[model samples]
Target: MAYGLSEEEAVSSISLSPCEIMGIEKDYGSIEKGKKASFFVSKGNALDMMTNQVTLISIDGVVQSTSNFQYELYLKYRKKDTTN
Candidate 1:
């Protein structure tokens, strides 16, 4: 956005534009019928790391678990140490 691109353009540059440049737009890029359904749902602007909290993800039309090993470890360690 600092480069003057709108939010939509910024997003497209990373998503749709790349696929189109790679000649895979027919199967990737912007969501459409018959196209591969793969994307992540974020709580806020995906362009902003501070606000881009991914809550869900889908790949080839299948929902995937968002929790990863690091996230799981964080969750486990975030609890107060009862044995202390």
Candidate 2:
């Protein structure tokens, strides 16, 4: 974005553009028939670190768990009364 690319182009630079360079655009970049259904769902803008919150992810047309060790630990610890 700082380089003057539009929001769409900036997003493509990280998604479609890379796949095109890797010669995997035919099966990886851009959602289309016959292409791999791999992507993530975020609650907010994916480009903004502060607002980016990935809630779901799918790979090769399969939904995946978003839970991880860190997230599990956060949930466990956050449930405790730290003020005590």
Candidate 3:
């Protein structure tokens, strides 16, 4: 995941580096520490653009919303109109 990203871009591109820099990294990004834990729970490989499906989610020791978590919702509802 830390492959093609520049320093600042990498930090800003994902919710990890910044969280770490702010000393909150222990409680966020990847699996570690006393963090409550959260996950997209994709059905397929996270690197595969075509197979990415965030089927389940957990946030802040709880599950808030699955079908409307912004990114997942976009992937779920925003299909390109190829009817033409």
TM-score of each: 0.88, 0.90, 0.53
Q: Pick the candidate with the highest TM-score.
A: 2
Q: Give the whole-model CA lDDT for all candidates, comma-separated.
A: 0.91, 0.91, 0.69
Candidate 1, position 15, lDDT: 90
Candidate 1, residue 58: lDDT: 93
Q: Model 3, residue 82: what's the lDDT?
A: 60
lDDT of 1 by residue, 2-82 (tens): 599998999999899999899999998988999999999999988998899999999888999988899899999889687
Query: What does the lDDT read for residue 55 in candidate 1?
Result: 91
Between candidates 1 and 3, name the one with more favorable TM-score: 1
Residue 51's C-alpha lDDT in candidate 1?
A: 91
Collision pairs in model 3: none
lDDT of 3 at 7: 57
User: What are the per-residue Cα lDDT tens digits for candidate 2 across 1-84?
Assistant: 658888899889988999999999999978899999999999999887889999989999999999999989999999898786
Clashes of 1: 0
> Clash number for model 3?
0
Ranking by TM-score: 2, 1, 3
State which candidate, 1 or 3, has the greater lDDT. 1
For candidate 1, the TM-score is: 0.88
* Candidate 3 wrongly placed segments (more than 4 Å): 1-15, 68-84
